[model samples]
Target: MTDPLAGRVLRGDRRAVARAITRVENGDDSTDLLNGIGKSLGRAFILGLTGPPGTGKSTLVDRIIAQYRGRKMKVGVIAVDPTSPITGGALLGDRVRMAQHTLDSGVFIRSMASRGWSGGLSGAVSEAIQILDAAGMEVVMIETVGIGQSDIEIMKIAHAVMVVTMPGLGDDVQVSKAGLMEIGDIYAVNKSDLPGADAMVVNLLSMVRDMKGRSPPVLKVSALKGEGVDRLFDAVEAIRGRFLSPAGEEMRLRSVRGMIVELAKKKLLSEFEGRAFARSVEVARKVADHKMSYEEAAERLVDG
Candidate 1:
């Protein structure tokens, strides 16, 4: 019945938070820690940032931390970096660009390795955000691995998904083909000072307009030069408010239901991967050899 993480994290202890995150990333079942932080939840706003590899998401997140800190708000950043092939550590880990805040006690930043996990986030991302949330961080930013199309999982964790893209990326086609144009609650065209930046914003607007009945704001920003970032922050608040507002209770309910489903799916996946999953690979190879149809292979897996 001794829960050490609960007290250390609630006391704003960085070491305890880091340990807890590592445990979660490795898929440890923190049933005790979960119950510890349950009452401490709902105070922090979770913001998710996801996009293609070269979208400058880390820089944008660094700027956002500064803005939030300026308002005297405590900020927590979970930057998901690609896992290194050999070492299996985070590739661009620790966010060197955001090094300025390393000394600031009000800002807590941690880089996580994707570890071959998809959906833009590592397995323990939501749990890490929960730790930060429980620690009294007012705003928690989850920056995905930024692997373009696989980043759809951000929608599951964020109250608002900021799909970050920049100019000269030929984003109009890439965004549409990647199926990311529909998942974002807010769109930010970064590097707006560059040429074709305005055009990119227009392209995003056109795509959003096609969604019909949903009016998510698309903005132009220069995360490098700090242009239009305040508006982006304001838009995040507005979008969250719109979801929690009187007229949008349905959306809130939907989000709750979605989270429940996500949790259930995670549990089931963990169970499947735990024992005799090698049988799945054996069956898959048989299917690949044309000895069985995919449907038959799936049924065999189910039977197993």
Candidate 2:
């Protein structure tokens, strides 16, 4: 709990912060570093942006970073990219697109390989977010890999989830689907300069009309042209303000609780995979031979 690296990270040293995140990504046991900064966590807001491929999510993130930095806020970005088969690393580093902020020092951007995580986010993203939060980043944004229906897992970790989409490419219908529509706190129709942008916005608005509680707002944004980005920033800030309010305390606490549960589950699953994998073949043979029931084999595995 008294790690020098953690102290440096807490002091907002960008290099130390980067090193901490790298340790997490490389699967090094970072329990001490995390504990060192545990008390300083939960102050930063976690914003998640997810959408299908070709939605220009990277460009939108670039614009959003400028919005936060203009207010003198320290911002952190985690861009989860697809895994590279050859190198087992992030295939498309989004840092390339946000090159303008390379020397800002106030902005820290990291690209992580999804590493075959099924949910479009890197497995180490939560740890990386905690590192950034401890580093005094007022806003930590997570841009997930291009996602589909099952990739809405970002909802569990993010304080606010923005689902970005564009006109054409059947995005209007895609957003209306069950999983995507339910997870979005806000929807941004990117590439509003395109032909079908207005209709896309209308379709989303109509879909969210009967969505029990606060309906997610649909915004028309052209990330490439900087159109409607200011308004988008205003909307994002509004959500941030709400999350920081007294009434939203339970929501924030719930997110923290969920994160803890997820971490515990991951730890248990890692152990189970390591132990149970070796017994799998034998267990399957016993079950196939009717020497042991499936339930019994499962119980045996768990007990071992």
Task: Tell me, by lDDT, which candidate is best.
Answer: 2
Ten contiguous residues with the weakest lDDT in model 1: 84-93
Give the Å shift of residue 15 in candidate 1: 1.4
Instruction: Identify the leading candidate in terms of TM-score.
Output: 2
Tens digits of per-residue lDDT, candidate 1, 131-232, equal: 898888988888774555435664566777898999988767777766677778889998898899888988889989999788788899988788999999
lDDT of 1: 0.74
* TM-scores, each model vs. reference: 0.82, 0.87
Runs off by more than 4 Å, candidate 1: 83-103, 118-123, 145-150, 240-256, 278-297
Candidate 2 local lDDT, 111-164, one digit each (tens): 787656543133367788989999999999888643553246545788888989
Positional deviation of residue 226's Cα in model 2 after best superposition, in angstroms: 0.3
| Backbone clashes, candidate 1 | 0
